[model samples]
Target: MTSLMALVVGVLYAAAIYMMLRRSIVKLVIGLVLLSNAANLLIFTAAGLRRDAPPLVPDDAQVPAGLVADPLAQALILTAIVIGFGVLAFAVVLIRRAYEVVEADDMHQMRDTDT
Candidate 1:
């Protein structure tokens, strides 16, 4: 399972990087989202998926060994997800504004407009 997840993460990351190099603003934004998901998945994997132990603990029960989920990684992933969302939202708005102001969606159109 881990190997499969790692492969998926690698493919997603590669695709994101490739898409980010495109001249279009939309593709770049999509690439960023993909990259963010890949990073989050990688972090989750790093925390170790222990099935034997439940993450939740009772008020009076002592925490069992190897049973606690790494809340730190979860928190970090949450933060990353929020930041990614903010960046993605900003990029979308910027792209929309650019489209309205420039009257074109393609990068080539904008470049040609300067001539």
Candidate 2:
């Protein structure tokens, strides 16, 4: 499962880079979203996959009875997801404003307008 997830992450990263290299601003946003997702998956995979219970312990026990999921990875992924959403939202707004100002979605055209 870890290997599979690693492969998936690799594919997502590759796709993200490909999309980011495109000339369209929309594609760049899509690439950013993909890149964020890949990072989250990488963190998850690094944390290890296990058929374990939640990271909880009985009142009398000093530790969990058996294998337990890593809470830190979950927290990190959750934080990353929220941050990614905010970044995506900001990018969308920025793109919209840029389009309004330059009347172009192509990065090349927008750059040309600077002259």
Which numbered prediction scores highest in TM-score against the true structure? 2
lDDT per residue for candidate 1 within 77-103, as digits (tens), equals: 999999989988998999999999888
The TM-score of predicted model 2 comes to 0.92
Candidate 2 lDDT by residue in tens digits, 5-93: 99999999999999999999999999999999999999999989998899999999999898899999999999999999998999999
In candidate 2, stretches whose alpha carbon ends up further than 4 angstroms from where it belongs are 112-115
Candidate 1 local accuracy as lDDT? 0.84
Model 1 regions more than 4 Å off: 62-66, 109-115
TM values, all candidates: 0.81, 0.92
Query: Per-residue lDDT for 46 in model 2?
Result: 96
- Cα RMSD to native, each candidate? 2.9, 1.7
Best by lDDT: 2
Clashing pairs in 1: none
